[model samples]
Target: MISQSLTLTWRSLVPLKNSPGQLLAMLIQPVFMIVIFVYLFGGAAGGDRAEAVQYMLPGVLVQVALMATIGTGMNLATDIGNGVFDRFRTMPIARMAPLAGRILADLCTMTVTLAMAVLVGYLVGFRVTTSPLEALAGLGLVLLFTMALSWASAWIGVIAKSVTAMQGISTAVLLPLTFGSSAFIPATDLPGWLTAWMSVNPVSHLAAALRGFTVGGLDAADVWITLGWTAALLAVFVPLALRAYNRRVR
Candidate 1:
């Protein structure tokens, strides 16, 4: 199963070789977000551009990681819609290989996205005040959260009736999660009701945990909360995704 998944992972990535534009777009996305959010909204939100870079970059990393999962769903939906899974059905490969392959391929792209975000943040004056190990841990945490979310996205892709449906569903769900949380502004800046919601928002915890990891102040509570959320997401979505994959393929 592992070998089959790895082969399919390469198969999934092969398209990027023929179409470098897709990979370029993925890498450029985080750079654009960093520039727009940190530079444009920094003064208004964080008192200055540098401060904004410090505060927003971690949040942006969480946001970008979350947003990247949408592609997983879309790709899965597209494959199903285009009958790629049907081709897989006849092969002797493990049933889970296709789904696992898609996810592994997504992890590769998301790692690059995270790296690009950090590079852009560095250029914009965001520094990791912690040790190199902590900075790496920060990236690892975000990637872990992203992997959990991808399972949910994969379920959506498997169950969605069409690629357009998958896209719509993903955007509808993700937009609120990204914009409603502390991804752009502090929770204190929001109204009472919104701030209340932000308190429970998984993204808020993720942002806080990432800030702790990359910046000077590391919060143990935030890290625990983020891990809890990751576990919850994986518990709910992993089974759903696998079941949905089986149903879709069968």
Candidate 2:
């Protein structure tokens, strides 16, 4: 199953090779976002663009990671719509192979986006105070968190009627979760009610943890919270996604 899934993961990435422009477009959004945020709103947030970059880079990465998971569902819906999944069913591969493959392939794409985000951030004065290894671990954490979220997306994609529907559903959920949390701004600045909600927001923990790793102070509490969320998401969504995949393929 592992080998089959790995092969299918490679197969899933073939589209990017054929349409390199798509990859470029995906990488461009982070650059634009970092520039706009740092130059326009940075002064208000952290007193200057450089300071803002230091504080905002982690949050920006959290937003980007969450946004990227939407593509997992959209891509799966497209494959199903095009009958590619139906063709896979005729093969003798393990039932989990296709679903696992899609998630793994999405992880690779997530890494690219994360790297681009960091590069753009650096250009805008985002510096990592932690060691390179620690920063890499932070990146791994983001990927793991994203992978857990993508399972839920995959389940939605498997059952969604169309790619548009998948995207719509994922966006509706993600927008609230990503933006409502402490991703772009300090939760303390929010209203009492919003602050209450943000306190428990999983994305907030993820963002805080990332910031801790990048800025030289590891928040052990936030790290534990984020890991708990990741485990919980995978625990709930992985089985559901596998079931959805089987039902859809059958």
Candidate 3:
């Protein structure tokens, strides 16, 4: 049954073989955002900024992973809309298989997007102060963060009444979280009110942890905070998403 479920996931990823354009579109937004931020924010404003790339790169990468969740949710919604979920429900597979499989299927695309984004940053003169091992760990952290969010998105798709509604609702939830946090700058750099919020924001912590890795500082406190938040998100969202999946199936 587990094998069958995993096969379903592999089958799902196979369709992308013919949909290069879709993958490209999925990746372009993050790359574009990186470009705009680096040029607009990294200019004279950041001239005195210590490790400008270190600061900006982490936030940019987080945005890439966070944005990828939208695509995952929307894809799942499409599957549900096209009657694929109904068909999968009828198949002999573990109940969680469909959701797990779908999440696994997206790993490749998400990894590619991350790699491309990092590569673009590197090309434009962003060097990691961290060693290769720490850099690898940083990559793992982002992957973990992305997966947790992806699971939440899957649940969103199952509960959303329609694919379009899923898109709208998820976008609504995401935009503020992305913009309101310290993805683009230090919390202290923002207004007093925004700074207060950012100090406690999980996204800010992740960005801080990432920045630490880039500088080889490996801020243990920030990393612990980020992991704690990711774990909490998984603990809550996993069951919720699973419940929704079961409901959709039944």
lDDT of 3: 0.80
Q: Distance from true position, residue 139, model 1, in Å?
A: 0.8
Query: Which lDDT tens digits does candidate 3 get at residues 1-250?
Result: 6787679778888888799898778668667877787766865226643456657877888888887887778888888888888997777778888888888778767888888888888876678887888877887888888788888898898888888898898889888777778877767666899888888878887877777777666679888888888898899988998898888868
Choose the strongest candidate by lDDT: 1
Compared with the true structure, what per-residue lDDT tens digits does model 2 show for residues 107-140?
Answer: 9988999899999888778899989988988888
Name every residue pair that clashes in candidate 1: none
Q: For candidate 1, write residues 1-250 as lDDT tens digits.
A: 9999999999998899888889899989998888888887887557777788888899899999999999999999999989999999999998889998999999998999989888888887899999999989888998999999999999999999988999899999998888888877999987999999989988888888888888868888888988998999999998899999998889
Tell me the spans in candidate 2 whose CA falls farther than 4 Å from its real position.
none
Ranking by lDDT: 1, 2, 3
TM-scores, all candidates, are: 0.97, 0.97, 0.93
Q: Worst ten-residue run, lDDT, model 1?
A: 42-51
